[model samples]
Target: MNYLRGEFDLCTGCEACLLVCSNRAAGGYNPRLARLKVFRENENLINRPLVCTQCENPFCMHSCPVSAISRAEKTGVVLIDKEKCISCGSCIKACPDQMIRWDKTGKADKCDLCAGNPLCVQYCVPGALKLVKKREVPGK
Candidate 1:
């Protein structure tokens, strides 16, 4: 399964990924609602794209009392079942990356690998975000 591996070195903090992701995920143009978030640090010297890693030991999955969150068998992508979510915020606290955010409806939201092709990667003009195979060395 491929997931977003964002390269800060190549990131320009354009926020295009955030816009597209937010639109798809939240049906609006709000970065805060986007599953992926970008943080600017050191007076914008570095742009960090924060996204779900879909860890093998995902804390979000385990923290969800209702089992609303689960990993996709075909793509290994972590997904949230909005219907089952209770807005308890346990998954939000469990996420180490802080990638998960509460939507307007109060459900936890995180990256789903766009079901296969990520809009973030497609719109990242700087090529900072990539959907790459899970590897031990990230590029090896």
Candidate 2:
């Protein structure tokens, strides 16, 4: 399965990823609206980027009361069906990483990997964030 990976050592805390991601996801440049988060650790020594892992057993997907959230079979990406969403915020609460959140429309929103070409990865000048594929384990 493909997922976003973050390397703290390579991160410069520039937040370029956040800017582009928010613009793509929310139609704005606000970092607060980004689907991913960068946390400063150890007195600003480390900038740890946190993005949706698109878990094999995603808590966000299971927590949706209306079944608005689902994993795309082809790409293995977790997605939200806006038409079926009820704005209940169950997914938000269920996410351990806090990747899911309320959008301007008051509905659940998360990263969709920019339709397989993540702008965050493209804009990460420090090479902190990357989209990578992992081999699925046998009989997991």
Candidate 3:
């Protein structure tokens, strides 16, 4: 499994990742519509990028009433099947990190690792975001 990792110390709160992600994910320029969120904490001393960990136990996947969400075995990226999805917003509420957002079609939208080639990672100039192999991450 490969996952997007972010370094808080390296983040500059510039929202470049948000911009590209929003453009790619939502086909718009709104940061509020981005699946990944950056939180400014510690009195604005640091920026923390909150991305979906693609959890070992995915709440979003479990919460889907119509079984719309599933993990890709090859990449370990959780995906939503729009054809099966009913736009119930259950997955959106089930996500603890607020990583899930609404698509233009009123369906759940989330980080799919950009199908293994993330545009957000490319736009992250501060080196805050990078894709980590499964073995590289602990407790995988």
Candidate 4:
């Protein structure tokens, strides 16, 4: 499986990735609606892209009362079944990385890897975000 990796060193904090991601995820242009978040630290010298790690044991998935969230078996991507979602905010609170967000419609949002190719990776001019095969390390 290939998980997306974000590099803070190459990030310029331009927020182009956030804009595109928000539009795609929320059908709008609000950064707050985007699944991916950029955290600026060190006086904006570092831009950390906070995305869903697609964890082996995702808390968001387990926290959903209605089973709205699930992992895609084919892609290893975590996805939300919007119709099944009741907007209870449990998944939002369960996320450790704080990547899940609330869209204007009040539904929880998170990255789905854009079904395969992520727009954030495509538009990242600085090469900060990348899609790479998962490397298995001993005991990992």
The alpha-carbon root-mean-square deviation between model 1 and the true structure, to one decimal in Å, is: 3.6
Task: Write down the RMSD of all candidates, one decimal each.
Answer: 3.6, 1.8, 2.6, 2.9
Deviation in Å, model 4, residue 70 alpha carbon:
1.1
Error of 4 at 120 (Å): 0.3
What's the true lDDT of residue 132 in model 2?
A: 93
What ordering of candidates by TM-score runs from best to worst?
A: 2, 3, 1, 4
- Among all windows of 10 consecutive residues in model 2, the one with the lowest summed lDDT is 131-140
Candidate 1: C-alpha lDDT: 0.85
Runs off by more than 4 Å, candidate 3: 135-140
- lDDT per residue (tens digit) for residues 2-104 in model 4: 7788888998888888899988977778777777888989888788887776777789999999999987767778789989999999998999798788867
C-alpha positional error of residue 30 in candidate 2 after TM-score superposition, expressed in Å: 0.8
Candidate 4 regions off by >4 Å?
Answer: 135-140
- The lDDT values for all models are 0.85, 0.89, 0.87, 0.83
Worst 10 residues of 4 by lDDT: 131-140
Candidate 2 residue runs with Cα over 4 Å from true position: 137-140
Candidate 2, residues 29-104, lDDT tens digits: the string is 9999999999998999898999898887888888888989887877888899999999988999999999997889
| lDDT of candidate 1 at residue 52, scale 0 to 100 | 77
Best by lDDT: 2
Q: What lDDT would candidate 4 get against the real structure? A: 0.83
